[model samples]
Target: MITPKASPAVFAVGSLTVDVKGTIGGTYLDLTSYTATASSVSFNPLGGYDFSFRENDGLSSKRTLSISLRNLLIPSPPDYSESVVTERGIFVYEYDMKSSSTIAVTQPNPNLYRYAFNDFKLSGKARHTDDTREITCNGFFLLQELTWPL
Candidate 1:
């Protein structure tokens, strides 16, 4: 849930128009199911996360942006358990084999636990004294499952 954009607009804070929304909660282990909220709540987002998005300033735009992104995957039959990094803005999560730090999924890789989320994340921080583009991240997703014995 990390989104950055820059479309048809002057840069340098001029002709500005920002729309940012974020939210994230931890404790996952979908183990397949593609996480679509049939129950078992706990930071639901259909059940899937992966956060980080901070780009778009233009420096002083002249109108030129071709940004586009879309990635979502979460569905398992069983095998997904991660529980660290507590929370991120709210995009993708599932990696807490104990603790190490390095989210996005990495333990075997085969849809480890499975994911399925889209809650919009990465918010600007700074107490909002005015607005300066804060930026935040920590939405990891690592649902695993892989076996080879031939």
Candidate 2:
């Protein structure tokens, strides 16, 4: 007898925030929306049935992370300052609606997702739309160890 594969579960976002570094080190909790595109293998058709794909050493690919937040919460310049961009980096965290208030090692909460965009830098300026500011960040790879949160 063959066992059936486990079905995927969908959960609502409880909270979303971006951790900014540098002198303006703080967390932006007013996130309206976010999109994270993890690195994917690119293929080029060589000929009949042959194809060439980029090297996938797991960390040698391009990843993108974009977030939209309330314009009222952004600074005057709109885009992140140069210092912050050169500092550590920005991080995006998301928690499930049903996530526990407190998480412990023994009782790990699998609902928490973190996207640490490596060598992250501002790829796009803040585009004002209505009352929100959309910012896009580019990096090498989004760390996804243990669990596939993307």
Misplaced by over 4 Å in model 1 are 1-51, 56-111, 119-125, 128-150
Q: After best superposition, candidate 1 residue 148: deviation in angstroms?
A: 16
Candidate 2: pairs in clash: none
- State how far residue 109 of model 1 sits from its true place (Å): 8.2
What are the lDDT figures for the candidates, one per model? 0.23, 0.24
Q: Per-candidate RMSD vs. true structure?
A: 20.2, 17.8
How badly does each model clash, as a count of residue pairs?
25, 0
Query: In model 2, what lDDT does residue 60 have?
Result: 23
C-alpha lDDT (0 to 100) for residue 2 of candidate 2 = 71
Q: Write one digit per residue (lDDT tens) for candidate 1, span 29-73.
A: 221112111112122244332222222222221111111112224
TM-scores, all models, native as reference: 0.17, 0.17
TM-score of 2: 0.17
